[model samples]
Target: MKMFGKVDVGGGLSDFWAYIREPRPHRWAVWGVALALTWVVFSGVEQYLIPVDRPKAQIIYFENWTADRSAGEIRADWIARARETTRRNARKRAEYQRFADSLGIEYDSTEADRVTRETLGEEAAEAVKQRPAPPPRSTLAERAARGPQPEITD
Candidate 1:
């Protein structure tokens, strides 16, 4: 065939070039089939063994490399819980104080007041027995008759 380069009847460098350049159509078809078969095998193996969730895989990999949590976020959550506890405790204490007051029991701040204790002898302190629970006031009409309750200040 004229299309074919000059073939060396004697085996030489030109013969080698011809061997590479003039591959048979059957050989090319075989190579194409081999490539297609390799691709199919690779794709099948990948589908069976390796998961394809790129985003979730990345997050899991990142967590493995780093610690599980952020310290700042944990600290903030703890602080919020503590503040809520403090507020609840303060409200409960206030409610108890109001109940005690209504029962006519004055919180003895005397224990807190060392100066008062030093000035007022033990005998004076003994004089302040639980102020006798005040007699319950009558109804609104009775209170109106009795006039406004006396205002007692500390």
Candidate 2:
């Protein structure tokens, strides 16, 4: 006994063509259902199986902590950091200016630089103004004398 009949690929295709060519509303409905099913299956596979683009984990260093540094040293470090930040911003501005020039865009570099400096100065002043004053030594002694207090709960 033959396990399989002769493969008739063109016959199957012709039968499919005939089925599609029939003037039946159900055929279009079946086609729409098939399309929807296929879309759902592909979407499920893509959602569950495919690897998506993701942002890589970043390691950010905010500052180098020093225990023995004086206030003068801290002030100097802040000044240096400010200067570096200004230099970096200026360099970026210059690069942008060059790019704009290449694209025939009118950019006033001097004016931009002046505005940037003014913004940076204002930010620095605001930060300094907002700096919290250290608690007085007497206040610290009083807190120490009070010891640990009971935690407040709602």
Q: Judged by lDDT, which candidate is best?
A: 2
Instruction: Tell me the RMSD of model 2 versus the true structure.
Output: 25.5
Could you tell me which 10 consecutive residues in candidate 2 have the lowest summed lDDT? Answer: 128-137
The segments of candidate 1 whose C-alpha lies over 4 angstroms from its true place after superposition are 1-67, 108-154
- Cα-based lDDT at residue 112, candidate 2: 54
Worst 10 residues of 1 by lDDT: 57-66
TM-score of every model versus the real structure: 0.27, 0.33
Per residue, candidate 1 scores C-alpha lDDT tens digits across 84-147 of 6645654454466557778756665444334333444464345334335546746678878988
Cα error of candidate 2 at position 86, Å:
1.2
Error of 2 at 111 (Å): 4.2
- How far residue 71's Cα lies from its native spot in candidate 1, in Å, is 0.8
What is the Cα-based TM-score of model 2?
0.33
What TM-score quantifies how close candidate 1 is to the native fold? Answer: 0.27
User: Which parts of model 2 have CA positions greater than 4 angstroms off?
Assistant: 1-63, 115-154
